[model samples]
Target: MRQSTTTIMDSQVNILKYNQYFLPVNLKVAKTATTLNAKGILPAGTIIDATGKVVNDGTAFGIVYENVDFNNSMGTENVSVLIFGFVDASKLPTAPADAAKAALNMIKFM
Candidate 1:
């Protein structure tokens, strides 16, 4: 038998500027040197590449839709990525680089 556990956390503020449209992609998050939040979770709005590695460069693929704590039994975890939507940049953990912003053309950062 196999078992899995999932923890649900709420965001204080909505990162999406509007509900017009948002695309969610399931991806296996890769372990990286990127710093985690106080809760040891990769916060929502954190940018990542197609390989699921945290990045702030032009290689950015999409934004995380929820907090993810992959430092557990499993070395990697599947997470939801927002490929398209209007996001409030101010709510992001860090400001995305110009190259990254340009790469995510479908995502509009307010």
Candidate 2:
């Protein structure tokens, strides 16, 4: 018998530009391994769509508030969605598109 091990490194990106006051809503995120994050770590500022999957289209629901480790699990997990706040776009793993920006008007992408 053989055993294998995998270690995921910690995230160092600061996605939130300003969060002194913001609105958060609990939502279920899709557990699609490839879509969530290629490195298995979903960083903050990632735009979520109606299907709870990562979307770069014009339709955006909200922004992820903190780092979420999917651990390569194929199941949904409830995460905090920032409806209103300042997010640093440069810090995001995949910056949202203009349509996403328009959809998430409440969130200011700096």
Candidate 3:
């Protein structure tokens, strides 16, 4: 995923659409990337991590997601980031300057 794609403070978190491994908004959620032939779905109110990480709460039923990112091809170099933590809307770091901007913009809308 391209870092710094959006601008939202604490709101630019990405969703794990389909089944692509992605960084969790927070670090408490469990994330896993899968390679499926068709679009997958996740149940609403699934309590996903800030970074779109799904928590392993003893659930196995996958919900049907409608977003387009989930269907992204998952093959060689299809790796995605996963993270979870206390989200900060105004704290921007330098290591991921791109993501910092994207996240700030995203939070602005939230």
Candidate 4:
């Protein structure tokens, strides 16, 4: 059986100045086997896996905007992520449109 976890990183902040076209979204991400630093930034252009977990090897869903990890425990945390429409092209040039569509669908259900 797979374990499902949700982690909250940061509260909503003003991102209008950065990308007027996109909105910042809060997502529940599962903690990986790797250790995460407290108040660590996930950086922009982070890819999210199909299960809604942030991963290095997965479809590009959104760009993280200096999100900080609040939970120090080896679990999940809620993090702020910016979707494709708002992310700069330089971030993920090869991001698939289908992936963005899929992410939007997932977010809608969430």
Q: Pick by TM-score: which candidate is best?
A: 1
The local distance difference test score of model 1 is 0.83
**Per-residue alpha-carbon lDDT of candidate 1 for residues 1-110, written as tens digits (9 for 90 to 100):** 65877666555446799877788899887656455667768888899888877899999999998887764635677888999999999999889999999999999999
Candidate lDDT values, in order: 0.83, 0.75, 0.29, 0.49
lDDT of 2 by residue, 1-110 (tens): 54656676675566777757578888877776226556677677777876667788887888777777777445777778788878888887687889988999888878
Error of 4 at 99 (Å): 7.1
Higher-ranked by TM-score: 1 or 3? 1
After superposing candidate 2 on the true structure, give the runs of residues whose Cα lies further than 4 Å from its correct spot: 1-9, 72-74
State each candidate's clash count.
Answer: 0, 1, 36, 6
Tens-place lDDT per residue, model 4, 1-46, is 5565667655643323444455567776666622344455443445
Candidates 2 and 3: which is better by lDDT?
A: 2
lDDT of 2 at 73: 48
Candidate 4 lDDT at 82 equals 63
Off by over 4 Å in 3: 1-39, 56-69, 72-110
Give the C-alpha lDDT of model 4: 0.49
Model 3 deviation from native, Cα RMSD in Å: 15.2
